[model samples]
Target: MADKEATVYVVDLGASMGDCHNGRDESDLDFGMRYVWDKISTTVAASRKTWTLGFVGLNTDETNNTQDEEGLEGYHNISTLQEIGPMTMTELRELHPKVKPCEAYSGDALSAIVVAITMIEEFTKKLKFKRRIILVTNGESPIDDEDDSITDVAEKLNEHNIELVIIGVDFDDPEYGFKEEDKSRAKRQNEETLRKLVEACENGVFGTMQQAVEELSIPRIKPVRPFKAYDGPLTLGDPNKYESAISINVERYFKTKRATPPSATTVVVNPDRGYTQSQAFDDGDVEMGGTEFSNVKHMRKYKVNDPSAPGGKLDVPYEELAKGYLYGRTVVPFSDSDMAITKYETTKSFTIIGFIPFDSYSPFLNMGETGLIAAKKFDEKSEIGLSALIHALHELESYAVARYVQKDGAQVQILLLKPNPGIEDEYECLYDVPLPFAEDVRSYQFPPLDKVLTVSGNVLKEHRLLPNQDLKEAMSDFVDAMDLSGFDVDEDGNPVDYAPIDEVYNPVIHRLNQAIRTRAVHPDGEIGPPPEILLRFSKPPEKLIKKARPDIEALIDAAELKKVPEKAKGRFKEAVKPLSGLDIDAILGQKKRTVISPENAIPEFKQALATAEDDETVEKAVKQMGEIIRKLITNSFADVFYPRAAENLRVLREELIGLDLPLLYNKFLRALKKSLLSGELNGDRREMWFKYIIGGQLGLVTKEESEMSDVTEEDAKAFVKK
Candidate 1:
């Protein structure tokens, strides 16, 4: 349980809020208000504490027209629609109509803050609670230079220890049609003023409306410290045969207190000033100058329903009633002034009693039924105690020690025990305390408390632990080949020289080696290291065909009609003739056949072309091309782009060019374009496909390249129209 909290939502109801945002039917104000309402509603519902909510409108026209020395006094347009108190869905629903923007001018935000502070202070005066004000606005209000009113309001809020959370909605969102050029100097000044106001609060969080709403919606539970194991030891007893003791651990659980509702009190108030008083007295009651004073009582009035009346209502006061205890009880009501404070207290205790022989208690520990004889005192009282103990043990759901206990001078003994944490009640226990030797004594070694554990030197010295060394070397070579820099830099940006291999690298390398050994196999008609590991450490194969003959045949058969031209049919057949006699099923084992089709490849290519500028899209394209290249290379094609599909490849290449990619990427695209245009390849496409082999290898296009591209806003609009 937590303490009570109060939150006041000060929403800006300016004319600008009426403008739609991001093409949405709802205005910015509508979205902002809805987000605020939902957030507050959710917080109230989910909070463990009692939460009170209030709503206030800024830039509203609920002010009086008053004149001062100046022609007309500035209006304090702040409107307190709902005072800070316990809020209900029905009450909130009724406020929708009242939250409309002002018809004349923007309301005074500074005035709204001052009013909200007053309301919250009045409401939470006697309550011990956390207070906060959530300001939802677009930061588009006119600044008031009247003695720094905004600063004064902020100072007052901070002095009261009230946290401020500003949800600033962007006015320039396209849906609002507020272009960058249309922003006025006043709007910028307002933004600066809002920022200053936010910074003035000690505990403040400022963010976009969406971000603020999301953060508020998320359930925020206060974190509790992790439970540490108890290091103290416990003693076990037999009470008759012998006492056996061992060091043990335990954790404590305490019950929580229930919340109580606030007490209500009745008070008399003055009608004129609306202030509560001890009694409702009039001027006539005080007759200081009179010779004598008369003591007269006053009767209160009430409203009663009457069907005969025009509005079915009637006014009356207390009158003669049936003389009974009920009427007298109603006249003089009673209430309790004293309140009870709840506290967490422990109600039960548990401990291990003793250990039993493994052979005798094994059945009971394993199957919940024991052959050991029950002690005489294992009666109703002990049964009840054992039931509670068993329930606690079951809830812990972990290992426990079983022991024999003698009671009431009985010959037979009972078994008592303790369990570990997180163990289930329904699970069978199959563990036992073993008597290791004929001497009936045993010893076990435990780690020294002060000792620091580290990896053994012998394990690091083993060569098999160096499998990841090759991977590291390959990575280094790849970086060198790519002319990469800044990977090993100091704080001052200078390169640091150190041995590539070090003690720190041993653990990572050993772990990687363990993973490889466990998951990979050796080559030679036997399972080999995974292709990824092999490819990282060694050069790629010229022909990426499976070891099995039937796989090669199957791949060739699938691609023959679609990929290979009639003139190249003989060459394709000759390339796969060597694999015609092997068993593909045995080599593949339980794995399903994976056929790479252009149907899948072309869609990925189109998607890549459309979003190549995106890192994620480029990465996906690289991976897809890797698979396509492997299949094409193994199927006797020197390149993926062949004469038979030149026209299709040419169209795709032009589309890639139209995207206006970076120079490095264009180079790779040019290679593909040239291959398509030439209708042949000198060697396997795999040899020159390194640039596109890794995803996210391309950088953003240069500014010059972006400007030189022919695509324009009008072009995109025309494309959309079509």
Candidate 2:
């Protein structure tokens, strides 16, 4: 199988396809394009230049195919939506809106296949590229097969080893259990024609449109070659000094790695291109202006706050700035020339420092990814030496702790290598996991749950805090009933495990990929809910939970666990009642107002804290001010109350800074930022953050602004972007 591929996707877009069929709400064209979009999006995601893709719109309103350009008698109503080349996000955007139903009612499906074949042929040019042509249609359009065109096309496809896939909408398929009751005569004839063509071709697939569309949800795993991370020696002990010490050349390769989803980037879209010329411009369609977008670039510059400057900030060039390390509220500056002295430079090496009993090495201590340390391939001497070392370690039931530096200037790591003995044909190897350094490890001690220590330091097992036998038994029963193992059944009705390791996929990665592809294909269509399998294990099975209700109820009663009343959702505010009924203000001989009226919030907030003598009074006043800001943001229209809210935040920040309580101000700002970003207030109020918090210079307080603050200058400057 070739890694590089040249695929041409032919989508039928005739007039009849525009009308919904077979009781389906969506048109035939829309239904068929779902499969096309999935395939195209997959190629785009691969991001390989060699794996090129071209899209041809069959029965389109225009004719712009390669065959038509060569003065062909047929191949009319065929337009090339995308050229035969590497697929990019730009190409995907351009091709998306173009794959729609055309006004042209009839076209030659055979002619479309010929056009696709010509595209792949011209692009691949007898190269070793895996060529493919996918045809998705309702088969309603007339395909002119009046001559050797069909035979000639099938022969060409076979000669090039091109894989042809034909999918027909509302077509009968006994294997798929799908048969249309009232299929059109023209469509049936075209379907048979396609089936015969597929039969003539060496590599071809003929299936119903429903069958192809149903399989689109299955994820396609990308093929990858195992890359050697480190090719060096796996040394044990000091081989130079001790003759009995082990030294064998080895190679390290990743056994497993966590897969991450494609990241989103911010770009500037040009509306002048094909977008926003009219009164009704869709903001969601960034490509409404013809899919033109410019990559966003970031520029960095250091600035120092200066009251004397016009903007209250003085810009400093990069050349003048010196790197500084924070040291106990002080910046220890270092110039570029002096930076080398601060670095701990070392050469590449992998040496076993010591050995420890396997029992002493806790698996929980493993911090990073695991990889394989195998003897250098095809080196008999190294292989034999490594095999002997592995056998010794396996016999001793021990693990070797090694210091491994992959390459010069690479990260130095502490690795725990466990030996694995091999059978007759299998090669012996060592499985290694990165270990944490002494400074990275943290230890905590807590009182035992089975017993409690009293004020006199005497342990008691039957105390109120300890769990009773009934509670323990009930909890055990509840846990057992909720277990997922054996929840699914096999072919013989045997209880099998649910969500096996290979079957379970990371929902976040696949869900996001699915969303991106869906939006690219159908920008206006409501995204289908996440696949059922992805969310199957998210919660306990309903049946199991229902069956264990008694145990759950008994456990809850035995433990006396009651739902704690939530405190107004943490940062969101509401009126608070003092349970003691003792007015602190009255006791201090000044009855401060408990609330800041939304209308006169600023002055009332100042008044509420004017007579404050303790942290509690100041905190209450700040909370009142915060509540007013939140209310203004929520209740007002658009940015009508934004300036007012910003003003409230400004006042609170200044007061906290002046009062030497930066922690209080920083905590509130973080919560406010989170709320604004998550659209909790209304539809992502990031504009408020950009305009007021960052632009108005009301970010986290740096140590320069407040002596008690721990925030560095760089952190304060970057907080707004985050």
Best by lDDT: 2
Clashes of 2: 3
The regions of model 1 sitting more than 4 angstroms off are 47-49, 64-75, 145-147, 171-182, 213-251, 254-347, 353-722
**What lDDT does model 1 reach?**
0.48
Model 1: per-residue Cα lDDT over 1-722, one tens digit each: 55678888888888877877556687878778757755554553343337787888777766531221224445466667777776543444456568776653566666666667777788788567788988888767775744477678778888777888876776333433433445568766776676678787787766666555444322233333333221122224432355553223222211122222223233332234432222213643212111123345566766679999768888764553222335755754322321112222232222364433323433323322222111113245443433444455556543345332222222222223433222554422222221222243345887444333446623242243233444445545444433323334688989654223221122333333423322221112232233232233244233322223444444445434244334212101222222356655457683321332554666556545443445455545544554464344345455344332333333343444454433334444445534523535444443333323212222122344364344455543343233
Q: Per-residue CA lDDT of candidate 2, range 1-722, in tens?
A: 44788898888888988989878999988888878878888777777778888888888888998778888887788888888988766657666677777799667888888888888888888778888999888888788655476788899899889999998888899999999987778778878888889999999999998988888776665565776899988777777899987789999998777688999868786655664333223443333324555556679988999999879999999999998999999999989889887788877999999999988978899898888889898999998998888899999999988999999988899999988888654767898999998999899999888899899999898977778898889889888877777667899989998777877767889888999888765677788988877787788778878887888888899888767545542222343446656876668896657777878988888776665667898898888887888777777687788888898999998877777888888988888888888888867687888887788888998999988899999998788666
lDDT of 1 at 253: 19
Q: Model 2, residue 191: what's the lDDT?
A: 83
Off by over 4 Å in 2: 61-76, 103-106, 143-155, 174-176, 184-193, 196-202, 239-243, 269-317, 325-331, 336-338, 422-428, 521-528, 563-722
RMSD of each: 29.5, 11.8
Q: How close is candidate 1 to the true structure, as a TM-score?
A: 0.35
TM-score of 2: 0.72
Model 1 poorest ten-residue lDDT run: 568-577
Per-model C-alpha lDDT, please?
0.48, 0.82
